[model samples]
Target chain A: MAAPESGDGNNGAARMVTLISSDNTRFEVEAAAASLSQTLQLTILDGGGGGGDGIPLPNVDSATLSKVLEYCIKHAPAAANGGAPNATAVDRAELERFDNEFVNIDQSVLYSLIMAAHNLEIEGLQSLVAKKVADMIKGKSPMEIRRTLGFPDPTPEEQAEMNAHMLEYGWAYE
Target chain B: MAELLRQEAVEKVAEIEAQDSEGVHQEDRLSELPDDILMCILDRLAVLRDVARTSVLSKRWRHVVGLLTEITLSAADFESPVNGSKPTFDVVVQSNMDMVKAVTSILAHTSRRTIELLSLRFYLRDESIDIFRSVDHTMQNREVVKASFAVFPEMRDMVCTDDDMVIYGRRFLSFFYNYPRVFGGLKFLYISCVRLGKFDIANIFSTSIELEYLCLNNCDCGIRSLLQIEHPQLMGLKIICCAFEKVELNWLPKLQLWTYDSWMNSEDRYPLSFGYVPQPCNLRLINTGTTLHKTIKLSDFLDNAIIRQLNLDFQSGSVGDLKTRK
Candidate 1:
């Protein structure tokens, strides 16, 4: 098991691990960054993704794996500090800017990232994507949310069910 | 054999192309996400009403709205004549009933989980006693960490009226006395325009151990006895337009801010006194009457207390005597 090191100073010399996507693409990342994913953290601690053996994520495609890694690497330092009390305003602002731009992608890509984040159990990434989807759905009606998410037109039965539900909780619509 | 393989590959490509054209692969991804992720999305909605509205999205969402941990029920949400007209007495009564029904319905349907925060704001009338009882019933079994109960009459200014004020005050005290368990485990409490006597206040302090912030606005219960607030965990206290004879701050070590706003006709000679507030505190006094006797000095009120900031805004002529105490 790769035990967590002591002391607060996170300088260069951090351990690295290799992650393999479903497409068999291998990418090397800092162990600390990849450990943001709770699922990978345990495996990495078990010395599974150390040296020759790479962690295989069969559910994540190459394109989605890269994006997930991008978020983890950026958030790794702040997360390492345990919400670093000494973190300056500029550092937090820069991270906020990165997060805002990170989720800007096509709808299909967003869904792919959501799936990967959920599967990986990355807390920050899951919340970020969820918040983005919530923003898209806020103040939108049921049909609008479906349309925004690229859902096909509901069948007549589904439409009737939705209408009945809406009528029941009509005050919520108001 | 090579020709046959090429033909099969071409047919597969055409099938993929046809599926792409139809967009069938883009199935409701939002609903397809796991329950926990959808819950995360639902939790981000600021208002619980919006969260409830999501139930109509699909059959899967019908029960997800029940997962919200915070519920805020406001009487205004049920107000009729939605176009900003004055609500009649009948309308107000109807809205109060509807508000109670809505809260009960939501609580009944929601998953049995500890609510993080539950706020109820409504007008207190004789008819609303049942509503309060229903609310108490709903809250008794659940764990509510922070709760606020605000009762205001239909007319905003009617809070200061004597008869109406006393009626509301009596109701408020009786409700707390009857069902103290409904307000248990609250960290933040704000009561406005409710009458409270010494025992009522004592009951509140004794029941709510985790109380951090308490605001009593325009309450008429402190007229007879000295308002003694002796809470160990209370951090901030605001008393506005209350007719208290004297407010004695007793054993509140964590209190940081104290604001007392009095009416112009208030005759209480010493409105406030600090006994054991050790924290650096800011005391703000606004619109205090100008009836200080000639022998009383402003410094006498200070009593050599260590206050970080003291802001005294008195009636016009009252400043003449205070100028010498600087």
Candidate 2:
């Protein structure tokens, strides 16, 4: 496999490789993509072996990781395209559209995205998904937020305390 | 039978559309989220006043606003301060003060644990001396009444700037004392003020053990220990136009990123520490009118941050270790 050419100044020349998760799962991606995570970059650099032999990701499951890769794949385009060239209104609109569509998925898919982004250190993807959740959460009722996010119902005493705390968050929906 | 079948099919379609996804994992859900994600979500969160209004509806999100590490207050967020001199700005000083008071009161009740980042951006038209005074007053009254010590364990970046009186010399000392642990673990902190005392530097910096990116903007600070970096995990530090008798670089064991500029002569220049991490995170130093008499010794090892570039600018000839500025 060809070592990926990193036009960006930061990571230098990184190679494309195959990564294997715990359940014999495999992902063929550019080394630059894996290097999005500082932890993986350092580990690969410090290890100093071709290790092109599919780096094993025992902690990550296949389904969750594929979702993370979807985020990574979408983000890979933005990264390759030079990430929001000149922050113009139209450019921002395009990015906003991309971000919205990128994160619009089942709650379970969103959850997996959040977790995998964290594990993989895809900061942009994580933020997009989080802002998506936050947007849905804002102006929503606690029960509604809980229901939307799949959180379990609160105990009675917990509810009372929560009600008291809610008195402090100043905004409301009519 | 045919009519019943049609109704059943439509009802089934309705149920599928109405179904929500609510069975996802919760533990480590927030913690495992990337830092930027947390920042974005917190960014969208409403003010404490707005958040409290939600408590009447349900229990889960009542304290969620309080749990947020980012607290932002716009001048428009509050009514003008009570009985204050009319400041000469679109944002009334009274409004700024009221917002500060309301935020501090909420901070008073917010959880002291795991509160890592606190950002206060004020459009102040007045000197921020009283804003600090009120915080001091809160500290004094803390023991007598309900008080919780602020433990910002995960605080990284703090931006306290804009039109205001809060960014002053002695004030940051109080800020340092009130939240010593916060700065100790920070990655980026930017503060702008008029003056900086010798004691504030000697005392406040003693507690910043793991600072990474630091920028001091136009503060008339003493330069006695301008490079007294003790941070074990520090990666970057930026100091601009500050007073310094000598530049002393000591024991920055893991420091990889450094930005320092001092106009004072070599007599005031402090020596660079030895055997510190040869790894270069990112190092940028600017020479004002004055140049270094000698290239103070850097530990024998080359900076090994595996960096793609090195930017160093000086007068006349180039130092062997320093690369081009461009």
Question: Candidate 1, residue B13: CA error in Å?
Answer: 32
User: How far off is residue B313 in model 1, in Å?
Assistant: 2.5
- The true-versus-predicted C-alpha distance at residue A29 of model 1, in Å, is 3.4
Docking class of 2: incorrect
- Per-residue lDDT tens digits for candidate 1, residues B1-326, read 43343234223322211112224356555556667777888888876676776777776676776666788888787775557877877777777766766665567654666778778787776656665566576676666667766666656644357676777778777776777766565566666666666677887887876788888777756454468888988888888877676778877989988888873243435666778888877877786465542333456665544577778776644643443221
Model 2 regions lying over 4 Å from their true place:
A1-14, A44-52, A80-82, A86-96, A168-174, B1-40, B46-70, B74-101, B110-134, B137-326
Q: Chain B alone, TM-score of each model?
A: 0.77, 0.52
Candidate 1 lDDT over residue span A36-66, tens digit each: 8877776666556668778777667788899
Write down the C-alpha DockQ for each prediction: 0.21, 0.11
Residue-level lDDT tens digits of model 2 in A62-159: 77667666556555545655566745777678767877887778766676666556555567776777677777767667677666656567679868
> After superposing candidate 1, which stretches have Cα over 4 Å from the reference?
A1-16, A30-32, A42-48, A73-102, A150-164, B1-32, B73-102, B125-135, B196-210, B222-233, B250-254, B263-268, B274-280, B292-309, B316-326
* TM-score for each model: 0.75, 0.44
Candidate 1 local distance difference test against the native? 0.71
Residue-level lDDT of model 2, residues B22-88, one tens digit each, is 4434522543444445545656556544454433433233344445554444444554454665444
Quality of candidate 2 docking, DockQ: 0.11
